[model samples]
Target: MPLHKVVYLANNTKLYLWKITEDLEELYNEVKLKDSSISRLDGMKSESHKKGFLAVRKLLQHIDYNDFDLYYDVHGKPNLKPQACGIKEMHISISHSHGFSAIALSDKNIGIDIEILKEKILKIAPKFMNLSHLDNLTEEEKIKKATVIWGIKESIFKIKNETGISFPNHIFEEDFNFEDKKAFAKLKFNNKLEDFKVQFDSFEDYMFVCAFQN
Candidate 1:
């Protein structure tokens, strides 16, 4: 029930963030799930994952939607059931990390990611990011910046949602200072090049990133 924050993004997109502070029973009782979601929830072995799943449903209710209004496609991207009034098509993206879960909704395509900053990212930075982007920074800064970069790629991938897209090979973030909290990225794959505008900010020890195709 702790709705952490809401951010309004470009193109009428809205990002809802929830900090998981409820126990499994509390969240399960509060969230009304469709049969598919119930099955998905039952299949989640980790209590942490279950909590994240329920928290996202809570976010939907906060905006006057519910599990019945949500569905996933073959690509695993979330979608909103069109309203009877013939409103604009709504696109949704969902993400969760250790203690947080987030959903971004928009009339335009958007991707969002929330990641807890951790030192583990440092060891694998080269696998998913440009190592030179971390140079001339303290260890702590490296973790934060690297995690943000990883989140950037994740957000873009969610936007693209294409198979065979490699994090380090397909998506690349344009170098930007950590203080700015925003950057740009390019995706090159299948003989196509596309640009994306990235926006990110940190809350507590986690980073929330959003991407809009440009």
Candidate 2:
């Protein structure tokens, strides 16, 4: 049938997400043929990995995947050839959950994340949330508030492309509300401040958030 959801953030940035439709076994077979790394399966784990990788490959073709040698760094982030397509730099992030996988690409640094809202987000809210943000929400509203906070943090994590930073506290989100369908965040790294705008949208059963610096 049709491919996954592809959202363009700008001329240089795009997001890809797959919504599964076909049988898992069939998809796994297709993925194995495309990438030999996926053919070693005899159990559930292999099947799951095959499906995810296939989804990733499907998304990759939607963008400029040619002339770019893809490799991963120590932290497992994908790197591209600098001079590919006359672009000096390329930044990308990948996320997948449930039956969906997503990739974000941009000329400058970018981070995109998707979350399926669930109740478990509430249990870990205190770890990443700040006092100011927590105080603004009532007890009954914690779960929804926590999910948005988690998404914002993930977006910032992708934007910063670094590790060892706290969310809401280190990466501060400024004035804009998801309820109003918009938000803005600022990340301070290496003594420089970078700003990003976050747009919240729903696709199927997922909550998608995209952040980028232009």
Candidate 3:
């Protein structure tokens, strides 16, 4: 199967998922042809990182790689400069787990995260789990709820394009049901509140969530 595919999630946002098929030599040569910078990176990391980078580079090509320069902020967020189209500035967030690499591209700030649903999620729940999330579920239900909540918080962090925000405590999630596959969040930061929409779905064995602020 082909490794690269694109989905239009919203008017301003697109999602790309890449599955690795080529060997390292082929991938290196392919990336080098598009951008010299990628050719310098070590491809021996994990398979996920290699696939993710290829997918991101392919997306960059679609947007005219030469006109815009790619650089990372101090916080590690990717930013793109003004392009020939005169469109709004573009922001991107990339997340990968297992064998899948997911990227979100949009004119506005965006964040996306994916995690395999596992029993281990229960063990880490307390660190970021809010009382409201716990109150709505039993022991067995908590694991899945916790996974979704974690994704929501991480997505918010990406949307804010900053760190140091509390996960489940300072940032609250409400008006969401896991079974219904949707959730809403109220993120409190710097004495102000912003609203977010979260959507969850199953892809292979992972639970994926995409969130953004308009």
10-115: candidate 2 lDDT, tens digit per residue: 7777777777665676664444232323343343375545566566655665454631345557665666666654635877777767677778877867677778
TM-score of each: 0.96, 0.75, 0.78
Candidates 2 and 3, the one with greater lDDT: 3
Candidates 2 and 3, the one with greater TM-score: 3
Candidate 1: 10-residue stretch with minimal lDDT: 83-92
User: Stretches of candidate 2 above 4 Å error?
Assistant: 32-50, 62-69, 82-90, 131-145, 189-192
Ten-residue region with minimum lDDT total, candidate 3: 31-40
Error of 2 at 85 (Å): 4.3
lDDT of 3 by residue, 1-214 (tens): 2545566777888876765566655655554343434553553476666655664565456555631356567887766656632667777777877666677778767889978778888888777876466675777567677888889888888878656688865677884667898788888888888998877766666767788774
Model 3 clash pairs?
A: none
Number of clashing residue pairs in every model? 0, 0, 0
lDDT of candidate 3 at residue 23, scale 0 to 100 = 65
Error of 2 at 139 (Å): 8.5
Q: 29 in model 3: Cα distance from truth in Å?
A: 2.7
> Could you give candidate 1's per-residue lDDT for residues 107-165 as a string of tens digits?
77899999998999999997898899998999999999998899889999998899999
